[model samples]
Target: MMTHTETRSAVLSIGRVYCDLIFTGLDHLPVLGRELFASGMEIAAGGGAFIAAAHMAHAGRKVALAARIGMDSLSAGVEAQLRESGVDLRFVEHAGDAGPQITVAAVVGQDRAFLTRRAGPALPATLDAALDWEEACHLHIAEYATLHEIPDLVSRAKEKGLTVSLDPSWDATLIYDRGLLRACEGVDLFLPNLEEAEAITGSADPQVAIRKLSLAFPLVVLKGGAEGAWVMSSGRMLHAPAETVPVIDTTGAGDAFNAGFINAWLNGASEEMCLRAGIRFGSLAVQAAGGARLLTTAE
Candidate 1:
């Protein structure tokens, strides 16, 4: 198994995909004996990887996705949407193990509740194609793919002088030791939210957590909703406040933020611009009904 090592400036994101089924206008929390009416209902493609990839592609950047989908009709629909968005879809594989993962979300006012079922693990592809990744500028991966599968990808990317970004989804109840830090040990930037930061550093302060993380990673971006986000890099911490807007849904704000920040960074924008872009993307996502429609369909 051989993976290509190149320092192209394009973004390659790998993560999960699920169908977003939402029902809006729940007047009250329904009890087991009660029937309630939903003001609206919508279905859209979403999930961590698909949304991020869509955002990057929407900004007119070269984006590719390494994801798994079911072989059923839902999977076919997802593939069609990805193709229409101009994302490089050669790496998307369909799984025979499980059908597509479907998320049934109920939106009440600004809050939502969801239930889901997944058929199998994210589809796996041969590394032969990554060996063909001669022009990828960066590699962004998350919970969708495990680190063991891409053990050599980071080192290869480092050798080619590419920026590496990682978002690790950790097990919350596990014992904290050296392994946690090592999850994102060698990368240019690490993005985690308030909760993840606290679990890793035993501190709730974004500033304090990022300051400590900065020693290991040259750049650290911690996201905090309403209180805004913080970027710590080059010995400077910047305040990235979220714009005032009516909160509709908070499904994909983080993924949207990641896309916006990285997209702007690659365009030579300042840290502020990167953050603002991320916030704007988040705001836009909240306004919509689903996390992925913003990227796949014209808004």
Candidate 2:
């Protein structure tokens, strides 16, 4: 049974969670016959949902993670971190098929590459309960893949009277899907990286891609690495420059930005302020090797 709350202050974040193995400071990517050495490595609880939720919680926003994780050894490896992330985990479903989801990230210079494996269904059993939680007025879908897996999620959340946001996390297979706009029909906010926007809109021009996207989504925020971010809404386009910071690893920087932007937007911040907040969070993300590193020292 879900109980109603007076304040709609919490955010419900839905997506998959993974145990991330991050390697930073590599000279180059690994070749077929050659093994590359990295200067540093860290194992952390990751995934678009977890990373963004962690940051949101770190920023003093109440967040609930509604996703699935495995009940396996790999899941055990990240249990401690997840428990300490400060994001509510009551909605996380632990099942045999959900275990062993993993992402291996290799960072060389300012660029990074990832190899990932996803197991089980993306939807969690507690999804409906999480959505019905009275404290949550907003729903953040961490990845387009999750939206694809649960096509009616946006409408379902909207039916519950919660505003919805979606991040089109880069997926080689789904980036070019012609049905993307349709799948995101009821999303209030659409966040995408420059590459994703270009791929989806089939245009190298960021402005053109964003303009086209704005026609579908009420708000469009495009994350541009190094070049900052762009926002399109209500027939207006806004741009914010990213801060130049020392680069360590860029594994989940975009997701961190999503947290900052979403949090501010939910709080009624101006468009420019939201972009600035996102840039601030993203700057902190690249200063460390892992996505949730700031939270380790947040308090």
Candidate 3:
């Protein structure tokens, strides 16, 4: 078992933690203006940053979360779960603006489409914010295009001599098309899906795309859902295949993969080890109901 205060390195996760409202084993999508029966429903505290950092925390690292939540019950509940998961909540902020977004999905196995309400825009956690960048071994930002666009936070973290890992949310589609490709300069590890990688590079073949992406950064892990994940760095490409499992809900599978991959790398594992560990953890995610659910069940 791994504890939160293990002495490997420091990890800071700055991004989101929202209530993932998931419906599983659904017969079919509901027709227009009609109701359909769901086999079961489960609510879990999940988001790209939350689940990723939580798993890393469980894997023995000093982890802190930099996030903003509204003054609502669900928001408070999400915070409570993070505390239980052993993530340091010192950077967790409460704003009076919009509540945390709720992602609703009709998930069965390894894929689902989520619906989110348009709340007010999320603010950035710039260098002027309350984060203590000097007290950590590494820092990460997740799905924060709005914040990184400022160009201040990334440079500041680099100035502080902190290694950075970044996960771009779907907003990359909007940001990448508009001259945002060079944003990869400051990031150490670039995590993106196959589709996003293609969009970022305009490459029809993702295998060729990963090689080009790694030239700018030390590593690039193009996450493919069923094909596992592929990594390219220093002119070498490695592939990690996924395990066959009875998938219940795959809402957070990719997030789990990021957690497993980064945690191994932070612990001084080789790039090859990181990719395999990531795929191993992600395979566990599918067998469970939610992203974080696999943590308690991991051997």
Winner by TM-score: 2
lDDT score, candidate 2: 0.89
The list of candidate 1 runs beyond 4 A from truth reads: 1-7, 27-37, 108-114, 148-153, 159-161, 169-178, 295-299
- Over the full model, what C-alpha lDDT does candidate 3 score relative to the true structure? 0.73
In terms of TM-score, how similar is model 1 to the real structure? Answer: 0.84
lDDT of 1 by residue, 112-143 (tens): 67777756655357334643577777777654
Sort the predicted structures by TM-score, highest score first. Answer: 2, 3, 1
What C-alpha lDDT do the candidate models reach, one value each?
0.71, 0.89, 0.73
Residue-by-residue lDDT tens digits, candidate 2, 101-123:
99999989989999999999998
Q: In model 2, where do residues sit more than 4 Å from their true spots?
A: 1-6, 295-299
RMSD of 1: 4.4
Q: Tens digit of lDDT per residue, candidate 3, span 219-246?
A: 8898988887898877889888877777
lDDT over C-alpha atoms for residue 197 of model 2? 96
Clashing residue pairs in all predictions, respectively, total 6, 2, 0
Which portions of model 3 miss their true places by more than 4 Å? 1-8, 118-121, 124-134, 144-150, 172-176, 297-299
lDDT of 3 at 58: 76
Residue 89 miss distance in model 3 (angstroms):
0.4
Worst 10 residues of 1 by lDDT: 1-10
